[model samples]
Each structure stands twice: as structure tokens, then as C-alpha cells.
Target: MLVSSIGASIVQTVGGAVKIHDMSWVTGSGKTMSALLLVPDGASADDKRPAIVLAHGWWNNKQMQDSNYVELARRGYVVLSIDMYGHASSDPLQEGHEMDAATGMYDGVKEIASLPYVDTTRIGISGHSNGARAANFAIPIDDKAATPLISSVYLVDNDPIYTDETGKYVNYYGDRDVGVQADQYDEFFFRSYDANGVALTAPRDYIGTPNAQSFLHFGADPSGQAARKPYTTYTQSVDGRDAVREIDNPAQTHPWGPFSKQEVTSLLTYFDKTLGAPTAIAPGSQIWQLKEGFNALGLVGFGMFLIAFATSLLGTRAFAGLRAGPAPALVPREGRGLLWFWGSLVVSAIVSGVSYWIISANTAVGTVSFLGDPPINPQGAVWIIALWAALNGLVAIVIMTVSYRVVGRRTGVSLRDIGVLPGWRRFWQGILLGAIVVASAFLIVFVLAYFFTTDFRLWVIAIPTFTPNKLAIAGIYLPFFLLYFLANSVAINSFNRFAIRGREWGNTAVLALANGIAPIILVIAQYSHFFITGELISGFGGINSIWLFPIVVILPVAAVVTRKIYRATGNPYIGGFIMACVVTIVSVSNTLTYTR
Candidate 1:
């Protein structure tokens, strides 16, 4: 209760400082777009204010930009954080409309511009990642329109300022003040490439490149190293307005850029320079970090709530029979037994790691691919994960069967001791209980979103409320997830159930590592190599599979939760089902959705 209250309160406090509303409107293309529109107190036609339109990249929604919305609005800028087309709470992308001007950013501009309290000539636009690409696309269209709407633009971790489609670099921003928040370790952009189409240098080396020099000098060649330096503001006059251009390189990865203080400071400084802030606060005076801390607290609270809720339900009369009488015996820690145990774990982890990389590299989910196009755009990534999980689950089944024959039969370990003999009736009841617990948890998610306009999150790991359509999508992926998680539960409860006299938590910590270390290592190795050498390490997997980074968090939590739920119910079904359902919902809802 304390954790839940603190998380909700911090969000409310931040939002209450401004009049925040969850709003949606129909775009020109006949699709609905959603946003959180924040109007500062005293904002009215009598007291007009500068407005800023914000957008998040692929696989994210409006809430992903909450820090910006809260900070900008508190500083007296009317802010509209949008759910980009094909992302959370918005209609799926239609064919031939994949890049609709700005993926709804153009619409966001029109909406904010139409507001009564907004100063028409003082509007700015900003976006991150693919959203930055959308902003890049929107600026030109808005600038060239009969009456231009945007006064300034800021793009984060996007492609080059000028696109070289016809073997000629075309500058899109005609006269709008532009700022680029280029991060040093961005995976996609701002780098010189080698012969095999690999980035030879990191983004920190970007300012010295021909592209950066040309852009910073406004299409002129820089004569000296100082002329191509970063963080220096440049200006040119066009059509009676000063078109300011500046670039700030923060030492961060593409995803990490949005969550950094350095990036936020750059934003504050840029917007203040171009559009001007109503309150002249220092760029370094930031409150977004406080909210972020509370968000992490909320994430912990969410995990605790799930286990607490499940435990409470298992104590009820309907679930009382599901509880087991005694704890299962641990696998022996003596010499040969220990070798077999550690060997199986190492082999399983390696298989899981290798299989995930191979499947992600090979699987392509699209209109023409074997999996075809899913209704939700991110289902392509989901299908890859499902195939990986299903494959691992099969291998786990084989490992467990062989281990039981080789070790368990001789040691007097029964199928019941391994949690595999929960009778069919009890198994069905456990599933029912799991479903009930998950349903209750999501009900809380809905309430939190409705009341506070917030959900439990810290960066890409989020648990947001989903539309009914997501339920149908979750159903399709649940079985594939279950095959892995249920098998995972058996492994954790049976094989790795260590008998530590006073270190129960040590056991959980070991189990968590056992379950998650492979993905953790993959992530660490990928980024570590990139940071050290300025190039991603070779022959890991498809870059698209970087989406699986969340698995590093999910698997460890699942391991811990599986053990906790097993302790409460003395079986694995309830916990496995719950994890599968929750993960499927989160995966299905947080990504892009495509229209068939």
C-alpha cells in the first residue's frame, strides 16, 4: 500500500501542478490519435502561452515522454505528448501511410495550434528515435504549407539532418530553428561507416565528419577543427525569422538519451532559446528525476502486489486444497550430483542464449514472411520471442526427462517431489486461481491509469493498461509463452531448489541468475563492445532482436515469482500461468500495431 500510494502520489503531484488531461482526436486520415495535453495554470486566451508537441519512438506511447510533458508544462509551456501512429492507444498504421507526414505529429501540431490559449507563433515540436524521424518529416511539410505552424523543432537520435536520396543532401527545415540531441552511443545514426556497412566510428566522432561540418555551417565547408565543434549555436536569417541550429551530444545510448539529465538540460536550453519559456528557470533545475525515482518504486510495488495478491487468493477456501503439505527435498550438493546439476544449468543457459540469437536473426515477421503480418505491429518481435521460448521449452523438457532418469530414479525422487505430478484437477484449479490473480492485478493497472494518468514503469520496462484488442492478441501468444515459463517453473522448483540453512534469499538470487544470466550477458557484451570499440560486436544476432533486452528483466522476475508462488501453492502452474499472461499482455500492448 505504501509503495502504491507513493508512486501514484508523485505522479499526481507532478501532473497537478498543471492541468493535465488525457485526450484524443480524429486525424486527417480518419484514424484516432491519443495524447496527454497539459495546460499550465492560468493558461487562457487572456494569458497565451508557448506550446510544444512531443512524441515517443516505435514500441512506446505518450507516457514514455512523461518527464518532458511534466517538466515543460511546469515551466509554463502547453505540452502535448502524442501516441505516434501504430503505437499505444492509437489506430494501427494503414498501408501506404506508414509515414503519414509525421506519424501523427503533423496532426499533433494542428491540435495544439488550434488551442485557444496557445501562442500561434511560438510553437515548437520534438520527438525521439523514429519519432525524431517523424519530426524531421513533419517540419518540412509544416514549413512548406500555405501557413507554416511550427516555429522550432528538436529531434533526438535521428538520421542525418539532410537526406541524400538522389545522391544530393536535401535540407528539409526551410527556416525553422532546429536543435539535435545526438547521443554518443546511438545504435542507428550519426556515424561514419566501413566497407561492409558497419559503423566504423561512434557518434562522438560525428561533429568532425563532413556531414556534421556541412550541416553546422549551413551547407558551407568548415575551414578549421573549431568550426566543426559541437554544442556551438549557429544562426541564419530566413523570411524575417532567425533559424537557429545547435547540436548537443550527450554521452548515452539511443534509449538512454531520453532518460538523461544532460539530454533534458539540452532540451530546456534549446526550447528556451527558440520558443522561449514562460518561466525563466535554469536549465539544470530539474524535477523529472524525482518522478523517475518514484516510477522505479512503483515498479517494485507492482511486483510485490502481484505476489501478495496471489498469496491472498491461495489462502481462500476455493484454493485451500491447492496448497501442498511439505517442501520438496533439494537436489544433493555432493560431488557427482553437484557436477550434474551445474552442468545441466550451464548447458541449458547456453542453449537458451544461442537459440534466441539464432531465431531472432532468422525470423522475419512481415506481410511476405512465414509468420505473415500480425494485427499488432510488434507481434513480429513477439513471434520471434515465442519461437525462441517454445524451442527452449522443448529442450528443457528433454533435459528434465533425462535428468530424472539419470539421477532422480536412483535417489528416490518422485515426480510429485519435482512438482510435475500436480493432479489434473488441481492443475486446472491452479490455472483458474492464476487467471483470477492476474485479472485483479490488471484491474489495478486500469484504475491507476484512469486516476493518475500513469502506469508502473521505468524506461522500456513498462506495465501499461491495454485496449481490448490487446487481449485477443495476448491470447494468441500466451500458449507459446506458457510452454517456456511452465517448464521454467519446474526447473527452478525441482532441480535448483538448494537447501541453504539460513540463506533462502541466496537460493532465490542464484535461481534468478540461472534463469536470466544468458540474456544479461548478451546485452552487456553487445553494449560493452560497442562502447569500447565504437562498433557493435560481430555475429550476435539480428539487430532487431535488441527488443529482447526486456527479457533480461522479465526472466529474473519470473524466476523469483515462480519460486514465491510455488512456496504459497506448493506447485508451479499458478505462477507460470500468471507470468505468461502478464508478459503477453505487456508485450502485445507496448509495441506498434499494424492494420491488416
Candidate 2:
């Protein structure tokens, strides 16, 4: 009853009820895949609605097409959003822990067909990047009865897997309609590849070659292959059937395309033409933003809950044993000087960026970095991030030591005043207190989710409680989180605590920037390049966008909390523990990890 009300409320917020469900099905290969199905209003089991299967690219999950789902479901088409193999909530392969992406999409098609309110004859498959390749792979396959499950397909900013050297895939796609929405300024797909698949001459012109021209024209070599065209539509015959083909060359870059209206409209236009009978809901008339905005509101609620939950307990007589010691006076309590002010930010960015680049490469998968088991994926990105955290902390220590020890002879600083290092007993007490705080927060969140069947989620941002599987994984990864936060707390507390000539706010602002400027600059540079030059920065394209803002916000927000805790307890450990545990839970719960 609670779940139904919650779901109803979310639907109303997004406009109206589009009956949504979490579903699972076993593939032909015995692997269980997870998916979300959105049923249109007023559709009975007997009224089979045209269905579309939406799959995300590498490291992404079902919510990648949130806009599409909201809009499409309102238009009366059943939408099935799947978490591909070895990702999110799917049952992953234990045999090598690696499975082909195509298999998941193939099984997703079958799942949509299994639904009572879905029309098996009117299914459309769509994917972005690697996911587009998967759709290309799955749509061409014959089911058990030798019938095609997908009648049409949409490929977003990627080459199809079926497009073999001999034009075999194009020949196969001739039976149905296909649409290509390639950003002309795609960093990797368009410019980074030659006819021979070598990664050379990047930022190359998109339409300046015979191979690309032929691809743009659906396997027919273009007479004018020497110039770029932003939009072209064509209809041709393949397999003795009229096949409609189109190539759109939006001037946008690759990374931001999936989330944009142009991309969604192009997709909707393609599906309408191919599938036929789609309701005419004009593009851009969407209320999904309200849902996303609600998510942001809930995220703010999450932070407030943590602060209230932790700070209130700390004030209790029972928890008073974990109180902080007195803060010691440090060098130049006025500030770390102008030299240290700007220097720390620049130094931290370079150190952290360089460290992340080198170390994460050893484990990153397909331009995305994280911790992985058999191979790197989004989860691997998580692991890589955790590793980067540790590396960053170590660098902070070295830099702090060097700045104090080697950089000055008369710095008026000693080991004793370098922030609070509570006595060993009190330190252990802080650890215990931190653990309780984490447990309390989780208890509250878990109850809400378990009983109400709701998570504090808004759009792409979420604060979700973990399942048993994820909780176990969190245990393995939590210590690394603690280490990073501890190092960060120590460095920021000691170095950033120096007042800006008694202007506490100014000092805090600088400190916050010092802590988070690396990611902030990285994101800024990445987006700026695409906007200014119309080309993606290539390497940071994939998973970094997920946590970009949230990850960076940690420093500024947590710095304030850390300072307050330091002011109260004179111990960085308490702040570090609390922040680390909170962030870990928030990130890990929301992220898609291997269910296996």
C-alpha cells in the first residue's frame, strides 16, 4: 500500500501514472537480466501497446533514458529499460565475469515480448554508443520461431556491430528502418578512427571520406564524399523491402547528446516513422524536470538528515564520551599566506589529476575507470576512484610535510599544532562513534525503503539503501574510503584552518576550493572544450559525468562540517569518519554494481 502510494505520488509529480515495475527474466543462456517496464495509462492486458527497449551504453544503467521513458510512456508505448550484463542489478556471469553486451539486449527484446500489454510485432530497439552496437546486434537476430523481435532500431553516436567490412550488416538492416544520430564533432567515433581502425589524426573532419559517406548513405557510396553535411534523410530498398534510412549530423559533441532534447526528438521521430501509430506529443513539452528537481530536493533532505542525525546524537549525554579535545594553536593562525593560498589549489589539482590518470589507466575499461573484477566497468570506476582517493591523500601528506619542513626555516610551525590528533583512546572512541552514526543513518534510510519501497531519488541523483549484495561489497570497499577521508581531513584541517585575517568565510571558501578544485577544473575544461571547439576531450568521456558535480561538492560542503567538528572536538578523525561513511553510503548505494 505504501509502495503504491509512493509510486503514484512520483507519477503525479512527473504528470500522471505510467505504471512502472521492476522485472527480471532468464535469458536463453540462463543468465537473469533486470529491467524496468513502464506501462501506459488505460492500456489493458488485451491492448498490446507498441514497445521500445532502451539500453544504456557502457558503465551506464537503465535511468540513462529517463527523459525518453517519461515522454514515451506518456505517448502510450510500453518502455522497457534494462541493465546490461555485468552491470547494476543484473545477474552477472561468474564464468569469467565477462559477457557480451549484445546478449543482454537480445534478452531484453524477449522480455518486452513477454509482457502482456506489449505488441510483439511493433517493438523498437535503441541504444547509445556500445549499447547502440548491442541493439544493432540484437535487432537482426531471428527468434525461436524465426521471426524478428525488433521491427526498427535507433543508433546514437556509434557504429553498429553488424556493419561488417563487406556491408553485410547494412544488407541485414535493409529489412527494417534504421536511424543514425551522430554528432559531427564526436571525439572518438568520427575523428579518432581511420578506415583501418587506427586511433590517429583525431579531430578529423566527419564527412571527408568514402567510408563515412557510404555509412551515411546506408551502404551506398556517396558521390559527394568530400564535404560534411549536418542532416540528410534517405529511403532505399534492402532485402526486397523499402527501408528508410537517415543520418543526422548535429554539430554537438558526443558526451552530452544522450541527455539533450535534440537527441530524444530525433529518436522519437525515427520511432514514429518506423513503428507507426505513435501519439503526437510534441518534443520539449516535458515535465520530467519536475521529477529531476524533486530528486535534488530529496538529496538536500538527505544531507540535512545526516547532519541532524549525527550532530544531535553527539550532543546526547550517552554519546558525550566521543567529545573532541581542545584545538591547539597552529602557525600563522591568520592564514597560510598568499603563497600557500593559490599554490595549494594548483598543486593539488596537478598532483591529483596526474595520479588519477596514471593509476586508473592500469584498470580502466573502455575509457572508463573504476574497480573491476574480471574487467573494469562503472564499478571499476568506483574502485579506481577509491584508489585515487588513497593516492590523493598520500600526496596531500607528502605535500603538507614538504611545505612545512623544506619550504621554510622560520614558519613558526611544529608537529604539535598540526591539527588535532586525539590521544589513542579518544581516537578509538571517535571510530566507535562514527560507526554508530553510520548505522543510525542506514537504519533510517533502510526502513523507509523497505517499508515504503522508495528511495530518496530525483532524476539521475539518488540516495538509495543497499541490498545485502551491495552491503557486502560496501564492506570490502569502506576501509579505503576511510583512509582517503582521514588523509583529506588531516590536510585540510591543518592547512586550511588558518584564518583569512579573521575573515572566517573567506578562509573556508579558499579551503573548499583547495580541496575540490581538481575535479571542478577537470569538468570545466572538459565541457569548455566541447562547447568552444565542438569536440569531446575523449578520455574522460564516460563515467566521470555521473558523479562530477556531487563528487566535487563534497570538498566545499564537507570542509564546513569538518571545521565545525574540529571546533567542537579538536579531532579531524570524527569529521573524517562521518564524512567518509556518509559519502560511501550515498555513492555506493546509488551506483550500479555487479549483482553477482
Candidate 3:
């Protein structure tokens, strides 16, 4: 089916040439797979056009290949950006989304190469992160992927996984065109590059690493390996075909590498070299970011519309039972309390920055790629993040309590006055009404996405409509996410915004700003090093820049809506419950998950 923005493409017959289509067909696994396929205008399968299959990292979907798909397709290859099993619109299997990338890639290659329009002999495969792992699986003489259809392979942020000291695989990569792009500061990257575990400070340094030495032989001299350390190309004769091989290490992190112009252009350039471009366009000229903007805009529209729908439904008769009724049981609120405004700013930033890197650093998610399947449970990354959220929530509650109790003990403000003390009737009512109201808005949006074959997204931040498996995953993850959002809402509403001195709008403005901007500033600070100095700033590893925009979008909205919901229903429970539900559902549905 032609879904969402997959049909969106630019048909430029001149130097600009690309037409993108979104569709899914049955794979050999008999599961449906989704892809964004771009063909150069007027090119048919009969055209024997060179083709490439692009895949994204672990816990990510097809959109992560955004820049590559746009740039490569424009350069005249039929580009297929596919969602791996258990992601996006692709039908989920019982297990093995990342582990079985070979099956999926081979499925695409067999179907694509069989097409008369595509040159079966010139097909290439590309992937980043775990997708790169899958791409590695597609090559070599391994049983998982023995596809002769692959003429070349492009690896981003990864090295050949199944390899020996000489970088020898089951034995087919020596005959194919290969390119490897590694980022300087990817936490998991250097493990494959260096055997003794020393990180690379330069590109060509990879030529000296453990299994990385395998890339040196694209028909090049073994003595010249040191000179071809990273970028300087080396080629050798493998079965008489020019098995052109190249490697580039750039100044970016693992997550942000695919989106960067320098990295992505390097990616496009490699394809242009091996796959052959029809028109000679400059390597760096790109407009894929504009499409990314459209996707972001869709997310904004989706979020704002949801808030509007929920707010509107509160006024309707079907939800008449939920209209503002009574107050809730409050803890205890005294006179005008200390806002802890500056304290919050400092603490939240410290907690966020420290937790962001520490949890990841301590977990197997960091270095568990080859550790015998790594026992997939809560996903080391997910568990760490969940712990991070719960800890932050505890901090928020503690800080809010301390400030309220210590600063002012004057006049009495009951649980009712502070707005948490709603009756039992209203407490349960909030949960019931909030669920119904939030679900209604979501169902409407998801139904539209279902028929349209798309989800609300902006660039890499995606909120796809769920499959049953994803929904089930969402349910499993809900309590953990709730631990974060519920604490956040309660803190912001109950204490963070307590004792407002000015007008309601001023209070709203301050609270919203306070709630949202800290993370935005911190996120931008981490990425500033990337944009300005082209390096990952210390203490903020594994932080994907894609989170910057959406967090900025949703946090303020979370504050505003929580305020509105609290005021309408006169309690914090309902508002917190609703916000938690929406946040968890949006987050879980959009991320990558493993089948357990």
C-alpha cells in the first residue's frame, strides 16, 4: 500500500532526479515488510539501474536512513530504505529483528535484483548501527547470507562482526566493493576497530586495528596498509573485479553520524564512486533536511491536535461525567514556599547529564554485541533509561518536598488547596476519564495513520501508530515510563509551580519554561560541540540529537496540558495519569523493541 510520505518525492529530470514511493510486499519469511523505494525518473527495472538497500540501527526504523535515501536515489540508483523486522510498518516476527538482518536484506536483494529495471549484478547493501551488523551478515560466505546478488557493501559506525585477526570472513567480502564509515566517539565502535581496546584518534588508524585490518585489501598492497589507515583508498584484485575498498572516520557520535552532512555526503560519495552516478552533482549539495522538516512539522501538528482534541472532549456530553467536579486529597501545603527555581535548574541538569552517560556506560548495552546473544530481557538500554527516569522522579519529589517544608511554615494550605487532595470518587474518575479521553484522540490519529500508512514524525523523532506487538511492548513499558512522567507532572503542578505571585498566564509561562527548557539547553549544549568543534563533549555519550526537537516540543506541551487537565478536573492524579499514558504510548510505539 502507498502510505504517508513514501509517495512524497521530487521528480527532477535534470541534475535533480528522484521519485520516492512507500510500499510493502511479502518477504520470504511470509511477513510483510515496509520500505521507501526511490527510483530515478524514467528508469525501469529494465534499465538495469544500480540499486542499494539501506537499513537503520538497533531500536530504530526506516526513517533513520532519511538523508541517505534522498541523496542516493537522486544520484540515480534505485534506493530501498527498509524497516527491519519488528519495526515501523514491517510485520514483526517472533524474534530476531537485528540478528536476522541477512534474511531481510537478502529478501530485498532477491526481489530487487530480479527486477528487469535494476542491474542484478550491481546491487549494493548499506546499514548503520545494528543495521550495519545486518549488512555485514549479508556479505561473507556465511550461511546466514550467501547472496551473490550483493556487488558492494557500505558499513556505517560498524566493522565486520564475524572476523579473525586478518579481517577474514567466511570469504566473499574480498570480491565486493566495500566502504566503512566510523565515527570518532561511538562508545561501541572502537571495540571492533581495536582488539586491545585502544580508541582511534584518527581515521587511518583503523587500518592497524584488530579485525579492521580486513578492510585494507581492496586490491591494495599489504605493506601500504598503514598509509591507507582511514580515508586514502586502496584497491586490490579480487576475482578480477575492482573490489574498491574505502574507510572514513569522521568527528561525530554514533547516533548523529547518519544525519550529519559531512558523514552522509561521504556516504553518498562512496555510492557515487562504486554504483556510478548518472549526473555529476556536487557531493555536499543536499535538500533531504527539508523533508526532515516536514516530518517534524507533522509531529508538532499531531501533538497539538491531540491536546486540542482532549481539551475539546472534556466539554462534550459523552465525557460530561468527567467535567470539573471535586477537589482531591492533598498532602499538605503551607504559605508561599520557596520555588527552588535555581535549585531545580542545577539539579535536573546534573541528574540528566550524569544519568545519561553513566547508565549506558555501566550496562551490557554498551559492549554486548558479541557476548553470546546478550540475554534480551528489558534491553540493557531500556532498563538503564527506566532507572534514570525513576531516579530523576525521586529527586524531583525530594527537592519539591524539601523546598516546601523548609522555606515556609506559615498559613495552612490543605491537600485541597494545593490541588492534590481530590476525593476517592474523583481520584478513580480521573484515571477512567483520562484514559477514555486520551485513547479517543490517539485512536483517531492512529486510524488515520493506518489508512494512510504513516505515523506522525519529524526527522528522526518518530511516533508511529502501533502494531499489536508494539502496543504490547508499550503496555510492558508503561509502568516504567509512568514513573518518570507521573513524577514530573506531580512535581511541576504540586510544588514546582506552588505559590505563584503573578497572573495565571505568568505562572503558566514560568512553569512551562522551567519544565521544558533545561533539557533543551542541556541537549543543545552537548550537540554544540558536534556542530562547532565536531566532537562529542565529555560526559554525554549515547545521546542522540534527534531527541532535542521532540523533547523541546513535548515537555512544554506536557506542562501546559497538565495544567489545563488539572484545572478542569481539580486534581493532579488525572492529569498525571493522562500525561503518563500519552508519553509512554508515543515513546514506546516509536522506538525499536525486541520480541521476548
TM-score of 2: 0.84
Cα-based RMSD of candidate 2: 4.4
Residue 115: error of model 2 in Å?
A: 1.5
**Model 1, residue 557: C-alpha shift (Å):** 1.2
TM-score of each: 0.94, 0.84, 0.79
lDDT of 3 by residue, 547-581 (tens): 44566766777778787776665566666777777
Alpha-carbon lDDT, every model: 0.79, 0.65, 0.64
Where model 2 places Cα greater than 4 Å from the true spot, the runs are: 1-16, 93-103, 143-145, 165-169, 195-204, 207-212, 223-232, 324-345, 360-378, 401-419, 440-462, 526-550, 585-596
Candidate 3 lDDT trough over 10 residues, lowest sum = 6-15
Using TM-score as the measure, the top candidate is: 1
Q: What lDDT is reached at residue 555 by model 2?
A: 69
lDDT of 2 by residue, 1-596 (tens): 23332543475224445777767677776877877788877666777789998887655566666667767787778898887775556754343333353648878887778878788888888887767877766754543337777778888878543346665434446566777777766654755455696555333355555445666566655665444354555666776777776666677656556667788777777777788645677765665555445545555666665556556667888667655556444434424455764676688879877765456334334233433563333355567677778777777777776666644325665544454456688788777776787787667666754443344554345565544566666666677778888877876776556656666667777777777877777777776776675555655653454446566777677777776666666667877888888776666555545433
Compared with the true structure, model 3 gives a TM-score of: 0.79
Clashes of each: 2, 8, 26
In terms of lDDT, the poorest run of 10 residues in model 2 is 362-371
